[model samples]
Target: MSYHFGRGWSKLTPYLLLLPGLFFYFLISLGPSIATGFFSFTDATGIKGAPIRWIGLDNYREFLFMGRASLDNLDALKRTLIFSFVVTTVQFTLGLIVALIVNQKLKFTNIFRTIYFMPVILGVVIQGLMWSLFLYPLGGPVAKFLALFGMRSEFLGGQPTEAFAWVIFVQIWANL
Candidate 1:
């Protein structure tokens, strides 16, 4: 037997081929997205079958105006914004510089171009894990070298400012 599509059926082939993708998209992506949007307006405890009361704007109020709210969430937001902006700026600047250097027709610049794109081939999780290992203060080689001075505090466990600083530095190092 052979599979064939008549001229009429050919017009529907793309949709037929896309059905599986559409099914999975609705099941995995759209379903959760709509649920999240709906849940935002309700007080739904994570417990299965629990009652979910409509509490429109109440949750948003606490996050926006509660006294202690700013200390926790707002501080985190500020730090994240700063870190992301700095890292993006560095990436853009470095990309431009590398592109300029590689465009100069230098012999070894092709090697640098290959090296620069190597990170792009790795998944974000893998790149993050590799950088984490590089900066791990306990048993990492970098930390071992610092251990000679009797220092043992991990990069991320130090003071808040310093820890955030290292986070920015490590992100830039990994991405650049």
Candidate 2:
């Protein structure tokens, strides 16, 4: 067995091997979070280099204390939180269930595994578009199916409750 003791390059070999993982961890994970913090402090819009003036904590303060603030933005934020929470919880539960089933020697395991992970392979934009199509009033499958039960009432429109309900429902359904 070839062994080296107190060699210069060999001492740092482990760190060299971990370079790729550390790089990606900082780039993909920490980069966005730091960028979000910076963005939150500025008045940047979707446009790049659009005179991003620093606004400090103004955005968060306004969001918290403004009585007549834009309802659309508030509702969207709420829906985003709801969608994230419900989708994460439901997908984790479903994954555990599938894992247990497969551990018990379920048949066609590979097919089932692929089916469960299919949504993960889909891009976020595509998944959002798919859900939007599915939630459209009177045109989507959900609305059409609800019509059979006389419960069709523009599932993705009309009011905040209806819109958010479909958002959470579709997020959980497709994610699992």
Candidate 3:
């Protein structure tokens, strides 16, 4: 009887030890996800003592089928898709080219690899700050270089198209 009891206890020990972590995971992660899904079908303003009413799929319908909001949402979706496609394609091509070059028996291969790998290891915040400093419209290195060639324009703070291009460039630079 003692041997069977010890075997059963040993079998249950790992699960017993995991109980607290499982409890917290349910409480913190799963609980909120379920609550968010539930709340999505209702009108809850997050105001204390506010009456919550079930609106069903009205909100989703408005977002997807209704007025000016739908147009804006579709435009945003289009831009997001374009951005994802451009970034993925450019990053893959550039990475492949760099990999091929690095694999060759060339002088300064280690140095070239290090230069290409530097942006990947750097934090996003550091990269953003460095780019901002380099591209700052007023008296930045890029602006100064452009001035030397008698061509001056804001790289980041310029017109919408220019700003968008600069953002894409920075994202590719940091990610690659």
TM-score top scorer? 3
The C-alpha RMSD in Å for every predicted model, in order, reads 6.0, 5.4, 5.4
| Number of clashing pairs per prediction, in order | 0, 0, 0
TM-score of 3: 0.67
- Given candidate 1, what's the lDDT at residue 151? 75
lDDT of 1 by residue, 1-176 (tens): 54466567786898899999999999999999999999998999899999999999888777767889757887888888998899999978987897788789788887888877877798888877886786677797778877899877565436788778777776776678
Candidate 1 ranges beyond 4 A from true positions? 1-7, 114-157
Model 2 TM-score? 0.56
Candidate 3 C-alpha lDDT tens digits along 56-174: 99888888789998999988788789889999999899988988998999999999989888897888888888888998878999889889999887554577777777888878877
lDDT of 3 at 25: 99
Residue 145 C-alpha lDDT in model 3: 89
lDDT of 2 by residue, 1-176 (tens): 55453577787878888999999999999999999989998888979657889999998988766766756568768877877887898878976887787667667888877766777898888888887787788679878888889886654555877766666665665666
User: How does model 1 score by TM-score?
Assistant: 0.65
Q: Candidate 3, which segments miss by more than 4 Å at Cα?
A: 1-31, 48-51, 65-69, 144-150, 154-156
Name the runs in model 2 displaced over 4 angstroms.
1-7, 20-56, 70-74, 105-160
> How does each model score on TM-score?
0.65, 0.56, 0.67
